[model samples]
Target: MKNRVEILAPAGSYEVFLAVMNAGADAVYLAGNMFGARAYAGNLNNEELIKAIEYCKFHNKKMYLTVNTLLKNNEINNELYDYLLPLYNSGLDGVIVQDYGVMKFIHESFPDMEIHASTQMTITDSGYADFLRKYNVTRIVPARELGLEEIRDIHDRTGMEIECFVHGALCYCYSGLCLMSSFIGGRSGNRGRCAQTCRLDFNYNGRESKILSLKDLCTLDILPEIIEAGVFSLKIEGRMKSAEYAAGVTSIYRKYVDMYLNKGKETYKVDKKDRNRLLMLFDRGGQTDGYYMRHNGREMIADNTKISKDLGEKKQYEEYIHRTFVEANPKIKINGIVTIKKNNPVTMSLSFGNIAITIDGPTCETALNRAVSREDVDKQLRKMGQTMFELDTLDIRMEDNIFIPLKSLNELRRTAVDRLTDAYLEASKRNNSHRFLPCAAHKESRNKGISVHVLTYEQADEAVKHNIQRMVIDTEVMSGDEISRCVELCRKNNVKSYIGLPRVDRGTYNVKSNSDGYMIRNMSQKTKCDKEVIADYCIYAFNNYAVSALEDYGITGITYPLELNEKELSEMDIDNGELVVYGRIPLMITANCIDKTSGNCHKGSTLFSMLRDRKNALLPVLTCCKFCYNIIYNSVPVYLFDKLDRIRIQPEYYGIIFTTENATEVADVFKCFNNRTKPEDNTFTRGHFTRGVE
Candidate 1:
């Protein structure tokens, strides 16, 4: 039979790491002191990481470091290598990465290292997975929303190892695409500080509820289907959880995974008591199967059961888990031989697996009182104490009149054990120097192409009058017939057409328009497109390599990230980069509607509503009742109209997003950009285009 599936667990802290290992995890993922998505977690420093790597290797378990957040240009150029070198040298099993720039840097600098595409990449189809294979990415933690059929399709086509989240907290918005945290306050989730505004109270009409709060995902019952679909690793989400949570959850999943692999599928079942424990660990209302079945369903949302309080006496076992894990024997047992002579130094030779270590004790002294006995040698050598090694066999030879001090023997035992530990660790190092074939270069059309992303036809009409080459419209805004008319009108004028898909694509948009392409928010939407796919800015293509990778995945054009400044963007040398010259930044996207929270669940309302944060900045909320999600745009538009002259050099196209702007306001925005007029303060913003996030 094939090897059983991996039971992957989260390690928030060192205690959690030990607990998870003790509970039986094949692998555990933890963030280090830098570039981790779980910034608030007690991420290990370089020293702690060394210990972690050694611990995993000693136990024959895989340890993947999380370098999963988006990094700015300065951070990439200045700090990435320094942060990674020691870990790489220490034999880190793999690195989970989100930023394309970071991945490219690691791939180029450390070719032998195993790279995993983070779930933040939102990989949805085989086309994208196969494309990422160029970077030698060994595995992909696909978006949490992908279904069984989609996962199987990706596996059959790409053959890249797929890791799916079997159990954990769920994000209401698609990961990476969410900017709600960034714009609302300045805490960017991509940088690992999500305020979790989604968990806040939002209402539908008169009823107040935690609409954006999603139930935790528990897929125990669906393990067989998941395994059959070719998921190489079953991941558990919750790096911000407790040690007891880690031990309990991991143990439960470990048991099921083993039972299913050992017995038949017919005998597989989730114990009732275990299920309740899982619920108590953490869940909203209760657990859902996640989007494994489908997307945009009411069953996935939670209106109550906000906090998961306690686990009765089971919580007390957390101490036991930590104590047991730290005390477990090394997976690789060592055998040793000791020799003592009258004058020469006593010699000890230790062997572990195929490797051997030898150390000499202090010069043997003649014991005038008592010669070193066989029992004395045995006692000293076998005193392994708290070390990770266990002396499977200890053989000693002493010459007549030999006198070796017990202290010298103990010192020899410690030295031999230390040397053997290093020898054991050396086996983990690999020379995975992967070779990459050169990719051909390409160019973008530097046509000063001004494509207006409009949510309304009034803005569309104004955009057509301007030098707009393309008019990207939200398909949710108009009916199929009306959108077709708008597409026809844009064609009647000289503009090309593209439909703007939502960040988390739940269903195919009913766009009967004769469109030229799609401006896709995430990779999952790429599968539904028949024409050109424009990788949206939310895809976070900050580096040339990332843009190239997306292009290889069938994306024809790209929108560079808003997080990059003008200097950073210009250096990227993107083949078909679309600079966001203008638009209000979308602060956050949520499944919770503010209008509903404000006691106005006006489902049919297209009117713009606003949510005032503590700072009194009005955040515009657009209800997408059809998709069961909402778009929360920032209070002010990012006006680079003043920098059009400075931005004239790079990117094939310069685009503007038109949200909530009337026909009059649209013309003013175009005029401002066309003539390089600097819009006044309080009316416009220069979001992150000048100052990047840390």
Candidate 2:
């Protein structure tokens, strides 16, 4: 029979791992004690992780480890190899990875291990998926913002396995692209320490609400459609939740999946009780269908006023789950045979599925006291206590009046079971002897001058008046004609002109431009333009390995990561890097439009709005209708005029980005950086230049 869609579940602890597996999860994705996106989850240690791997292999299920966070240079270089070596040797099924550097290291050191691209990689297009193909990325968990049609297109085009979240809490900002938590409180989502800043209340046009909070996603009703869209694995998202929640949710989804596979979609239907049970487990007010059916909508936001399940119902459900899946430990069934003769040594054989093993014991003597009966041999062999295996059938073959000590029979049974277990574990073990080499340091080069990224023509005109190296015109904000005029203006002033691509490309934006190069945010945008591509900070060249990886793609220059402090940056080789010295850092690039959610969407028009935090700080929100996304900028722009003296490593280019600033403001900020003077106002932030993320 053909295989059904795999049901993937999350397990924060070893107990939860067993619960989900027993509840019918085909595979479980979990984290070790380090480098996981859910840093606060009760992650397993190295020893427990090895045991989890063995359990999965014995049960014929799969296990995937979550190495799905950006790794710092020291962590990836010094610590990662020793951290992953044991699990890799013990036959870890796969690794869900975010960092390009980590993927490269794992692929080289453990060549047989499969790599699943984490959703934190922000993969949205097939072009990017195709790019990762060379790195041995066998599967991709695309950004949750992608629609079903978009998902199908990716699967059909690249033929890469697609894993998607069918049920979970949703993030307002796209995964891997969020800096709100990091910028706000130094708890970076990229580093697996998100503080859930989006769930906080923000005032939008005098209305105080959790505007950025998204409802939990529950796609039980649309399972058939998702499977038909070529999703190879259906993932449930709640590693931070309880074991009961993991098992309960897995059981329900497993029921429906089996229903759909056994009896066609015509008979696949979720009962009301099961849906209510999911809600009783946990929810953010209520749930939404997510971006599967439609893009973004106001309905997708959590309604905090909605009624929640009572304590009694929740307690009852948890009890049921514990009794059903947690307490009940599923055991492997094996057939056994015991042979006892007068002169020959006593022997026992055990068989499970395709594997069979036999053990030899002490010789059987003549009748001394009482002859060993078939019942005696069967009783001793059936005593498989505390072992994973349970005897389904036991056959006793012996000569009449054969005397065998019960102690010898017990030893024979124990030996047979031990050999079977060793065989099972040995089958899963791998022999990867490859060694990892350190990434080579980049050669030092001369520093390039200042470059400006402008979102408006007024800022562009003001930027060209100064002595700058290059100018990047954002195509999402400026028209083709306006961009062309700006390019010509830059050329006339002896400045190289580059076109800035949209943050999220749905394959609608035109890439045709007569310019020096393209400044791309994602990997998919790299293939769209043939010009000298300079990667934006969103591409995340955090470490030397990542820098080397991006450079191997023929990228000309890379932007320094905004989350890193100056000390961290000093450790990295920044010869071909650009440091953003001035600008409002983009906290979030989201698919949900702030304007449309507020009942005022100007079709294909650029608009500005303010999101007032509880402290009365106004964060600038840029609604780019043309690209159909919103960019939430930090309240204060980063001014490093005085701090420039503290930076030890000088990058190739000093970048100045203009987002909400007008021509006059842009000129003032530019003058401060150029003249090496501090701004009079105290509204500027030093950003992550001082305190780096944990």
Candidate 3:
């Protein structure tokens, strides 16, 4: 049989785990008390973990543990390794991870353990997913930013086992690459303990918050398409949820997948009753299909409710009680009466076995019998003090008579509390690691690297002064005086600037020129040609004409607009120059800003996002805190620091830019870049546009 869409469910508690398993989940993912991203859930402890594992195994179900948090340098040392050793030994199927350091550590130290790349890694394309193959990752959870075609393409091209989130909350930023949550709060998403401050009702500039709250992703109708795409797993997001929710959602998805596979596409309809049942269970901001279909943002729905808030109140009560009694235990029979003697007047006879324990008033106390344990017996008698009393064992107690107070028993309650506290504390200790590894720095830039679309003269001067080897001038930004000043600056500072010369108007560079005498005769097609030619022209303009344009303007090295692979540059004539290394990859080109995409800006409609994955995360759009545009498919910012040698496609200008709300980190980037020498080019100079003595 073909690989069916495997239904993956989340289990935050032992009961939820059982519910999902019984509801027919193919596999269930859960987190322990600590190092789990959801800090607010009734997570399992180590003992419970063992039980969960054994139960799943006994039932022929698979259980995946979540280690999907970003780690700091100190967090990855002997302590973490020690904790992980047992988990690895416990026959865990795989671990979901995001950070490269974590990936490298797992790859080298525990090659036997299966590593599934977390969606936080933001793997958007097949190329990116292919990059993880070297690490022998068993599967990849692609970024949610990808469209259906993109997902299918990545699945087909890489042939790696792919998992996608079919339901649950959607993040505003790309998974794994987000830093908003970490930036705003000390709790790191990568460490599996995220303080979802994102969901708060934060207001900015008197408007509703836009950083943490986001619509949930729901893809009930697209099961067949997802199955057709050959994704290995369909994951549901809700580690912290009720058993009812787990059963309802899991059963619904399970029923639908079976229907589609058995009877073919369009053979089944999701029962309306099941849909309503799901709605009553839990939902945040309603639901959305997200970016699977198109780039539009309005597809998300919002149906905010008090379900989570109500459930939270219940959780607090559970924590204090230490035990959840679904129903009162109807065992352990005892009936007794006590007599109280005092100087004043108090005597009482009580029979707890048959009474509800309430009396109209306190009367003279009588005892059922002389207490075997006097201290325990007196404790009950003291309340009825100061009068004569008679005592008896019971009014009519039989040997097998059953008795239990509707009220709680102190001895039983105390025992349960101690048990719970022990469990919670031990689990806490097992997961807590106070430190992380020392922060590692990225590789050094060869020369000052490339700058593009600079908005000011100071930006130009800084690039030139720093040896920013190449600069790219957007066609609209290029001016005669500006170009002249830039050319002069490059000469003085030993830098190079590439100006965007309009290809349509320029001779051989512009594809649209019909004039044979003009340089356009050498071009393959006009400006409005096919996309392949457009791409080709963009590449060629950066590699050839842009360089000449810079040289003509008294500059030497020019930069390019498009990020290119070595193969693309090799096909075209290009000189050595730096390309954008570390930073967010710009995805969609837009004429308007994202403010217009803000939906329902009323008091209750503000949206925020969190790096819902296990890592540095933030709501990207409204907050712009750690927003990455290319998150539609999970992927990280471009990291070309690894391959500085083969980069060539220089446009009229080129530069490397690092943007962060934190200034110290930004400054640190320049310092770190200056310290390391490139393996490809030892002769390269730092902070320089071009290598030379002015």
Question: Which candidate leads the pack in lDDT?
Answer: 2
Query: Across residues 1-694, which tens digit of lDDT does each residue of candidate 1 receive?
Result: 4457888999988778877888899999998889999999987778888888998987779999999988765576667887888788889989999987677778887887889999888776665654466679999888787888888887888888999999988987777777777655567888888888767765444345565678889999999889999998999988988877887889889888988899868888889978877876666787889877764466677747455567554454545544555444444467989888877888999997678888887888777877778988888898898786778887777787668768878888988888988888887775544323233446645656887898887788778888788888876566566677778878899889898886665444542346888888866577677888897888887666576567667788888887766677766757777888789877666555555645467787555676655455676777877665678788788877777776534777788998888999899888888788887544777777777665
How does residue 477 of candidate 1 score in lDDT?
65
For model 1 the local lDDT of residue 144 reads: 82
Which residue runs of candidate 3 sit more than 4 Å off their true CA positions?
197-212, 301-458, 461-492, 495-593, 599-694
Q: Each model's C-alpha lDDT?
A: 0.77, 0.89, 0.48
Poorest 10 consecutive residues by lDDT, candidate 1:
432-441
Error of 2 at 218 (Å): 0.7
lDDT of candidate 2 over 1-694, digit per residue (tens): 2257899999999999999998999999999999999999999999999989988888889999999988888998889888988898899999999888888888888899999999988888888975687688999999999999999999999999999999989999999999999988789999999999999999998899999999999999999899999999999999999999999999999999998888878877889999889989997889988999998999998999984858899899999999999888878899988788888998888998788898899999899778888888888888888888899988888899888889888888889999998887887788873767877776585755888999988899998888898898997688888999999999899999899999988766778988999999888888889789998999988888888788877788889998888889888865778889999999999999887888877877788889999889899999988888999999998888877766786888888999988888888987788678889887888888888888
Candidate closer to the true structure by TM-score (higher is better), 1 or 3: 1
lDDT of 1 at 660: 85
Candidate 2 whole-model C-alpha lDDT, 0 to 1: 0.89
lDDT of 2 at 303: 92
Candidate 1: residue 145 lDDT (0-100): 77
